[model samples]
Each structure stands twice: as C-alpha cells, then as structure tokens.
Target chain A: MAQPIISFNNVSKRYPGGREALSNINFTVEAGEFVLLTGHSGAGKSTLLKLIPAIERASSGTILVNGQSISTLSGRGIPYLRRNLGLVFQDQKLLFDRSVFDNVILPMLVTGQSHAESTRRVRAALDKVGLLDRERANPVALSGGEQQRLCIARAIVNRPTILIADEPTASLDDEYADAIMEMFRSFNQVGVTVLIATHDRDLIAHSSPRVVHLQRGRVLDKATA
Target chain B: MNALIRHHLHSLRQSGVRFASAPFAALANMVVIGVVLALPLGMYLLVSNVQSLASSIPTEPQISVFLTPGAAKTDVAALENRLRAVEHVRSVRFVSREAALASLKRSPGMADVISTLRENPLPDAYVVTLGEGSAAAAERLESELKGVPGIAHVQVDSAWVRRIDALLSLGRSAVILLSALLSLALVAVTFNTIRLQILTQREEIEVSKLIGATDAYVRRPFFYWGGLLGASGGLCALLLVFLAQVLLNRNLSEFGNLYGVELRLQFLPVADAALFLAFAALLGWVGTYLSVSRHLSKIQPR
Candidate 1:
C-alpha cells in the first residue's frame, strides 16, 4: 500500500487565551481516502484542517504530508506546499470584486499556468461546477449554493492532489448540500483525497463515510464505514 | 522564468486596471505629487537661470589706474604699456584728462555742471581689464598695479560682481534645501497612498495568501501601482514647469526689452527631466516596498 497522503502523530494546538484547540491528535489519511471530521464548535476541527496547509502549526508533534515533515517548511516553502492542496472554507471566501471566471483562474495564475492553458482549464473547472454560463458574472451576484460551487471550482482549478474543506455545506439547503456532497464524491472517485470537517450528523448518517469525531480538544471516536 | 515574466506583466496590467477604475482619485493623487515636485524643481531652475544671467553681464570688472598729478602724456603712455604687460592685465585703455572731461560734458545732466568748473580737474587714467580669475586674483593685480611709479590710486571694480556671485551661491544652497524637503514630502505621499491601497485590498490580499500566493505575488501589483502613480506625477510636474516657463518667459522678455537686455529663461534639461522621473519612480517603489513588506506580514490566512 502507498504511504498515507497525510499523517499527524501526537499533534497538539494551543491558541491564544490559553485554550487548547487540539490535544494529542493522531490520524493518518491515505491517498484517495475520503474522511469526515465531525465536532461541535471549538472542537479543533478547523484547527486540524488549518494545520495541513501550515496556516496553523501544531504546538507539539509531527505532521507528514506525502512523506515530507511540514515542521521543516519555511516561509518560502509554504506556498509550494499549499499549491498542492485544494482548500475550501465554509464562508465561501470568493473575491466578489472579480468575475466568477477570474476567481476560478486565480489559483492557476498563482501557479503560473500559460494563458491559453489557464483559459481552457478555467472553463473546464467552471463547467464542472455548473457555472460555465455565469463565468462573467461577479461572485456577489451568485446565489449561496452557486457561490459555494464557485469556491469549489476555484479550489480544484489547480488540480491539487489533496482537497480539504471546512464545513463546506453548513448553510446550504438540503438539496444544495446533497449536490455539493455528490460533487465531492465525483472528485474522490477520480482519486483526489478529500477531508471535510463538519458538525452535520445527518450528513454522517446519510453518506456513511469514515467518521472522526472530536470533543473539546481530543478525539472521542473514530468509526470506519 | 516565463512565469515570472507573466507575473510582472500581470502586475502591470493590474496597475492599469486599478488606474482606470477611478481615474479622478488617481489624478488627484498624481496632481498633489506633481505640485509638490514642481515647487522645488521650479525654484532650482529659477536660481540656475539667475546665476547664468548674472554671469552673462559683459562688464569686464576692471582696475582703474589713476595717474599721479602732473604726470606727462609720455609718462601715462609708458605706464599704460607697462600695465598691459602685467600677467593679469588683459588690456589697458588710456583715458586722458581731456577725453574724460569731454565725456562728462556729454552726460545728460553733467554738461552744465562740468562747464561751470574753471579748468579740467580729472587726471589721466588707464582702465585695466583683468583676465578671467577670482576676486583674490583681482586683488593681486590691484596690488601689482599700485606698485607702478606713475600710478596714484589703484581701484578694483569687481565689488558689484562679487555681490552677485555671493547671492547666486546662496540661492543655490536654498534651492538644494528646498529640494530635499520636497523629496521627503513626495516619499511620504507615496507611502500613504500605498498604505491605503493595502487597507482597501486587505480582503483580496488575504484570499490570495490563502490560495498559495507568495509574498512577492501579493506585492507585485501594488508596487507597480505606486511606481505608475509616481512616474505619471513626475510627467505632470514637467508639464507644469514648462507651462510656467512659457508664461514667465513671455513677461520676462517684455521686461528684457525694456531693460535693453535679452533675457533667456531655461527649463530643466532633458537629462534632468529624465532623472526626475526615474527618481520619482524610485521613491514610489521604495515607499511601496516599505508599506508592503511591513503590512503584508501581518495579514495571514487563519
């Protein structure tokens, strides 16, 4: 078997105000595995996802992504690490000042894709998220579900090997949430590693994916589906 | 390398995009910078032109070699030839007592006064033109001329020229000080502009950082934007200076005609203008660097 795409051994996170966000957290996510992390507010799920991109660092222990210890990553090296990751936020952090097409094209632009190639890939990514016809429209004009889809398009535009999303479907309606989940399913079927942090018990029951539950700052349960 | 080029091109394009978005605001910023830059620059040009004009006055600042009382024509002629042979004396013109009185009689208000005198009181003199040298050299020549046997009073006429020279140097120093102060103001203006840009684009900067944008990538556009604004401001300053020269020169030429002298006012030379533009751009770049490096580090995706 291939090495896990992500590994965390005895990880701990202490934030300001003397609050421990994560404590002795241990997890390994293999390539192409789809994992769901569920917890209440302040359960360290967000902190865990942030650590993978080096947005937040663990206070104690080692995290190896694709066999590379992230503790050794320098400021200049973080961008390269993040380029190989697809991150989606719950708030759908899209640049409303830009068109949907520009938002999707941003990640590719950062990675220095050629113009012709960027155009083609941007269109393809927008098409995948069902926003092809609305490419020129500003993100501000997009509906909530459509906006989330736009964020997904932007996240995947770089064709990252790992996709980590924090509460991607928290505010969407049931129908929209199902649509978003199916999109994630399609990406996982194509061998992209997917890890989603959410507190929606309904999603865990309906989808029946591998569930990792956190309570306070400790792992309470890990159930394989 | 190709990607780096593309990024730079994109930054330049972003600058254009930002400029076109709110032209009035950008123009306001540029005009402020232009006015500040033009103030000191205009002073410098004015001072330089005045210095040049003062130098161009054709008065040969000479030494008046007064002859001793009862000196004969032959003695005066010999003294004039001897003065001309001196190293510092470029030329010596003999002015006899009769010529001096005749010139005084031809003066507008001096004819009657000179005719009232019983006899010619003026003595023979030699107007000795000094070669190109400093006031000290003139003094040396004066001392040498005084040593001549037939000479009475050796007076140097460079007092007025020395005054003008001193005033020109003072003007030059004042201009330099003004330029230094205004240059500081220019940098401060650019720094403030970039700081505001960083604030307004804070969201965009955060988003870019989240999606794997490097610090350089995040900073490139604002850097170009600052440079563009400063360079355009410099161009506007040049235009202002030229327009002022035109209007001022027109009035000055009229004054020149009245004074029987041709007054030529010069604008900044091409090299100086080019250097000004480059310096403005450099200030803009540095200001952006200071703001961006300081502020960008504080904005991280959490």
Candidate 2:
C-alpha cells in the first residue's frame, strides 16, 4: 500500500481578530486519492490548502507532506515545496504577455529545465490538454473552459505528485464544470493525488469520493463504523 | 538553463517594451549625472588653472627690498652682492636712485614734474630674489636683510603670493564639499530609477521567484542597467568637459593677451577619466543593488 502523501494532525489557525479559522483539524490523504473538501464559506477549507504549501503556517500541531514536516518548512523552502506540489486556481493566474506554450512551461522554468526539454514537455502538455495548435495564442483568446484546462496543464507540466485546487468549478457552468471534473478524474485515475475544495453540492451527489465536511472551523462529518 | 533565462528575458520583455521608454529614462538619468559632476569638475578646472597662473609667476625674483633714501649707490651694490651670497638668495639686482628717478621721469605724466624737481629723492634699492617659493626661505631672507646696517625697511612684496595660497586652500575645501554632495545625488538618482523599475515589474519578479530563480539571477539585468547608466553618464560628462576645454582652448590667445599669461586649458587625463567612469559604475551597481534588495524582499508569495 502507498503511504499517506498529506497528513494534517491537530491543525489549527487563528486570524488577527482572534477568530479561529481551523481548530484541531486532522486528516490524511493517501497516495493517488481524490479527496473533496465540502464546506460553506469561511469554513477553513482555503486555510487548510494554504497550510500545505507553507503559504500559511499552522498555529498549533503539525502537518506533514511526503514524510517532511511541512508545518516547519521555512519561507525559502516554499518554492521547492510548491515545485513538488501543483496548485491550480479558478481565476488562472497567468502572465498575460506570454503565449499558451510559455504559460504551460512556467513550472519547468522554475525547475531550471533545459530549453529543448522544457519546450518539448510544454508542447506535449498543451497537446494533452488539447491546446497544442493554440500554443502561440494568448490565454485571453481562449474560452473560459479552455483557460481552466490551460491552468491545469500548467499545474501538471512539472509532474507534481500532489495537486491542490481551490474552488475549481465555482465560476463555471454545469457543462464546463462537468468537463473540468472529468479532466481531474482522468488525472487522478492515474497516480496523481487530487485534493479539491468546492461548494458545488451536485458535484459530490453522484461521485463516490470520501467527503470531509466542515462547519465554521470544525469538522462536522463522522465516518460510520 | 536557457529555458528559464529565455522566459525571464522575454517574459518581462513585454514590460521592457511597454516600458521600452525605460532606456530613455536611463539616458536622461545619465545626462543629469553628467551635469551634476560637471559642476564641481568645472570649478576644479578653473581653480587649477588659476593656481597655475599664480605659481607660474617667477619664483626666482620672488621678493623686493626697497632701500632707504640717501643710501649710497656703491653701498646698495655692496648690499646686492652680500644678499646674493646668502644661502636663501638666488640672485640680486642693485637699482641706483638716479636710475629709479630717471625711470619715473620717463613716464608721460611724471616727465614735467620730475624736470621741475631739483633733486632725486628716490632711494637706491636692492632687489632680492629667492631660489624657491617656500615660507622658510622668505623668513630666512627677511631676518637677514632686516639685520643689515643702514637698511631702513625690508618689504617682501610676495603679498600676492600669500593671497593666491589662501585661495588655493579655499578651493580645496570646496572640492571636498561638492564632491561629497554630487556623489550622493548620483547615487540617489540611480536608486530611485531602480526603485521605480522594481515597482513596475513586481509581477515579473514574482514569476521569477516562482520559477526558482535565485537572487543573483534576478539581479543581473538590473546590474547591467544601472552600470550602463553610470558608465554612460561618466562618458557624457567626459564629453562635456572636453567641450569646455575646447571652448577654453579656442579663446586661449584672447585670454593670454588680456591676462598676459598663457591660458591653455586641458582636458582631464586618461587615468582620471578612467577612474571617474569606474567610480560611476561602482556607485550605480551599489545604488541599484540597494533598491532591488529592499523592494524585492518585501514581496513574498502568499
């Protein structure tokens, strides 16, 4: 059996207002698992994801990623941690000037990949995402659905072991959301670990993935014996 | 790897183009730097030339000893010989009272007055000269001449030399002040330019950081930018100084005729020019480094 890729042990977070964002949160994401975190707004779902990449430090307890203490990771190691873990956003934070091809190769550039190899990999990733012919086209020219896929392609181009996506389908229509979910499922069907935060209730209606429910800053769901 | 550098160079190339006007800003900065340096530099040149003019006055006939009235001619001649024998005196001339009276009467306005005068009331004078223009030599000659019998007064007419010496000292103090101030201005200008650049390219820097770019790698182009500005400014200042020298050189004959001294102005030496440019380059690099380091550290990915 594969070891747990992400572990949150008694995690907690406190904002400046003394409002507890996350309280004693404990969870484990196994290798190749697709986990959905379902919660209302301000339920600490975003804070949970922020803690993993060392973007935010847990106030108490510890979190581990790939057997490394992520809670103790310094700011200097954040980029390295990000390189190992892919992050995708719904808004698609892409450099407007670069083409689709350059956008996809961003991770490889961070990794200091050689020109030819990075180019080949970028082209291949775009081809996988079905935007190969649109390599030279700007992200603005692509449709909303295509843009989201481009963001996904960018995230996975460096072959991160774990992918963290925040609100992947909040802004998309039903059909586009379904297409994105299908893409995520395809990626997870392989060896990639997928963790998604979304409020699309219908998203988990038919999907059989394990659900972690949260109310405010506390876990409300209990697994049946 | 080139893939990263390619992205880095061309990625912000859009920003570089959008702000393609950045190089023009840098050029303007260079002009300002040149002007600032030229201020002190021009003063230093003018004062140096004036110093040359002062020192170029014959140090050989450095002092004059006016004789007292009724002093005998042979007595003055003997005094000249004795003065020349002194270690401080390089040479001496004995001007007879009759010769002084004749020269005064030769003047246009004084000719009639001197013809009406019955006797030559002028004193026979011994004009003393010194080997070097040093204070010790002047003091030695003064004490020796004052002690001479029948010598009424020993006037060391090197008073203008004393005034010139004071002016040179004042000029040196001004150089210290202006050089310090102008260097500060140059550095501040470079720092502000780099600070503006950092603000404009915040996203590019963030992306570079995201791509695992090291601090050194991110700082390279800015180093080039600031250094190029500093060096180019130094070059432009050199040109301005050369133009000034040429202007002075062109009018040298007129100034020579007016002042009765050669005023051939000179450009800075090659070694000085090189040192100027090197200083500019170092200051530019330091200024940009400070700006970039301060601004870049403020941005950490959230």
Top candidate by lDDT: 1
**Could you list the CA RMSD of all candidates, in the order they appear?**
3.6, 5.5
Model 2: how far residue B268 lies from native, Å: 3.0
Candidate 2 chain A worst ten-residue window by lDDT? A216-225
What DockQ does every candidate get?
0.66, 0.32
For candidate 2, report its TM-score.
0.79
* Per-prediction interface RMSD in Å: 1.4, 3.7
Q: Put down candidate 1 lDDT per residue, B1-302, tens digits, no spaces.
A: 49999999988999999999989999999999999889887888898898877777744568887888887768777776777787666777888889989998886668878878999999888887877665566778788766677778888887677788888889889888988888788888988998988889888888888899999999999999989988998888889999999999999999888755678789888999999999888877887888887887898987
Off by over 4 Å in 1: A222-225, B54-61, B66-71, B74-124, B129-134, B140-154
Residue-level lDDT of model 2, residues A43-159, one tens digit each, is: 988888888877678999899998889878876676777788878764567777779887887677667687788898888778777889999999899988888889888888888
The per-model lDDT (C-alpha) reads 0.87, 0.78
Cα lDDT of model 2 by residue, B146-199, tens digit: 856658878777756777778887997898799788878888888998888778
* Model 1: residue A98 alpha-carbon error in angstroms: 1.7
In Å, residue B166's CA in model 1 sits off its true spot by 2.6
